[model samples]
Target: MTVTIESVITCPSCSHQAAEIMPTDACAYFYECTSCHLLLKPLAGDCCVFCSYGSAKCPPSQEQKGCCA
Candidate 1:
């Protein structure tokens, strides 16, 4: 499978959305909403904020072995 690196994160607080570049080396634990300033964290059981709220999974999560492996 081709690993997707782009993710669209929509802030749950204000419904704002932004396309962000996902890091390939590490998990992004927190993301600040550019529109509302809401700090976003990964949902329960998720590895990173991108995995929780993004349109695509984080790079680490996309690995064949799973996140943070």
Candidate 2:
């Protein structure tokens, strides 16, 4: 499968959305919402913020390689 690099992350606190590039080699544990400035972390059972809040899962997960986290 083709892994998508881009993802749209939505902040639960302010409902702000931002497009971001996910890391290919590692998981992004933290993210800062550009609009609300709320720090984001992966929810339980997720490996990265993208998995918990993004439109797409991170590259490693997309490729079925589990999570680098």
Candidate 3:
């Protein structure tokens, strides 16, 4: 199976969304909403914001290699 690196992250505060390329070496813990400027963090049990709000999981999670601590 090929793991996709692209993720469409949606901002919960303002519903803004963006397609971003996830880095394979690390997890993205925070994301800022472009429309509302609200800083987002991983929700409980989520390793990164992408896992919690993105259409695709973070690269680490996609590879089943675990994400942020």
Cα RMSD for candidates in order: 1.1, 0.9, 1.1
What are the TM-scores, per candidate, against the unseen true structure? 0.91, 0.95, 0.91
Q: Which residue window of length 10 is worst by lDDT in model 1?
A: 60-69
Candidate 3 accuracy as lDDT: 0.87
Of 1 and 3, the candidate ahead on lDDT is 1
Clashing pairs in 2: none
Which pairs clash in model 1?
Answer: none
Q: Can you tell me which runs of candidate 1 are displaced by over 4 Å?
A: none
Scored by TM-score, the top model is 2
* lDDT at position 30, candidate 1: 93
lDDT of 3 at 15: 86
Q: Model 3: residues >4 Å from true position, as ranges?
A: none
- Better lDDT candidate (1, 2): 2
Q: What is the C-alpha lDDT of each candidate?
A: 0.90, 0.94, 0.87
lDDT, candidate 2, at 19? 95
lDDT of 3 by residue, 1-69 (tens): 698999999988788899988888888888888789899999999998889999999877887888764
